[model samples]
Target: MLVSRGQQSTLLNRVKIEGRGLHTGAPVAVTVNPAPPDSGFVFSRTDLPGKPSLKACPERVSETSRSTTLEDANCRIGTVEHFLAAAAVAELDNLYIEVQGPEMPIMDGSSQPIFSELEKGGRKKQEAPRLWRKIEEPVFVREGFASLVVLPEERFRVTFVFIGPPPIGHQVVDRERDWEELLPARTFGWLEEARELREKGLARGGGEDCALIFSSGEAAPPYRLPDEPVSHKVLDLLGDLALYRPILGHFIAVRSGHSLNNKMARKLKEGEAGSNARKMFADN
Candidate 1:
């Protein structure tokens, strides 16, 4: 896909979508409205009084379990990665997302739905040049068997590895495919984990329809694409990175999830700060 160059962008019109939340099981109505350039992606809780808003940034990430959640003083937005991933791929720089519930609708457990909506809504370029974080050095994080590594690159790219139990073993995907190629890859969970999550008041609205359920000894549902699970992980990483400015780097993630992904974002943010500081001192 051709990356949007030079100017920043936002939706040209307001787009609305309604569906059931993955965890809340309650219906939600979301309106994606255009905002002035440089505003970044922000969320507003319309169901609550005062309509509190929260910026979608790595610093505001409050939860990174099976999904990513953001929080402000008293407002929270859950399961936001899929939506943010779509926005990133669309090269959107500013948006005001108003939600009528605590979480976004599962929307087939992939980013394709969100991308389609944004495509129909259209995009408009702004006056300011789009900002980007270009990694000049390698940065990495490791925990147990998982790891995330960022290397300097001219464009954003990702390589992800997913390792699951039987019926789904180790899978590796290396590519710079466009969002359209990866957007339909659905979030997946082991059958046991899915049941436990539901018992803990999560994934209440999830079923075989929205998410892929894997079993220890049974077959996985027909895949939308080869290595769909790992592709979805790549999608999640893209969404997490979208929390900050677009990155010009290559990411290598192995057995990683949202927690590690968010940690990488924090590290990258710190790296940017440090780089700016060094440049300032050198100029003096």
Candidate 2:
């Protein structure tokens, strides 16, 4: 079980990473720096004028196609799940991300690269206590065959079920495994989808080096773990949920994608707002 920390934390040192965008194929550079307490995760577009910034929040999410994208009137950022996942697991309370392109660098197609950088930067505890959004009641959301539920729990946990075609058959991942085991699991796609994705102006930077390509009933191995794809689904789920405040709950997901995950995040944020309002009224 993942227990919540009592105090909030941020990076002790700044870290930088450079790579190509997974979808845009554009060269991108990111600098992760520590922010003041309660600053949360803020992404600033250095490539744009005035360096417009957007805080990582469910209401700011503009797109959930294949990946999560955050946008505001002045700037936009794409494919942020991997970075957010790393930050969440690291228990980082505040960070300022400076982006030099439209999307985040898709390093090794997993959260491992970002996680490693966070470790190198080290963690520093702040003065304020962590603002954890504890699940007092169950929250559920669904999209077609996909569904996600958050139940009251003492610690953070995720159980994911991935159902796909042929070589990428049925797979299930539960809380038995550690979060580190899921870090190296790369994103994946069918070999046939490559061309179509490129034609549609997506996955331009994707390749065997950055993602696992399944062909002829087999994934291009060696595998990072037993079921890498399912592990990645869990990673994505955690990242999407990070849009809300730190949570203490058991997340059960079934074939849920970014879209459904974002919907659940928005719901949680709304619930948190209502909760805070009630507490304030009672205190008054």
Index of the highest-TM-score prediction: 1
lDDT of each structure?
Answer: 0.88, 0.88
Q: State in Å the error of residue 180, model 1.
A: 1.7
* lDDT (Cα, tens digit) per residue for candidate 1, span 1-284: 11235899999999998888999888999999999988999899999999999989999999998899999888999999999999998989999999999998898999999899998999998998787887778999988899999898887788888887778789998887566799999999888888998889978899888998898778878999998988899889989989978987889999988899999988887777787777678779
Q: Give the TM-score of candidate 2.
A: 0.93
lDDT (Cα, 0-100) at 162 in candidate 2: 94
- lDDT of candidate 1 vs native? 0.88
> Which residue pairs overlap in candidate 1's backbone?
none
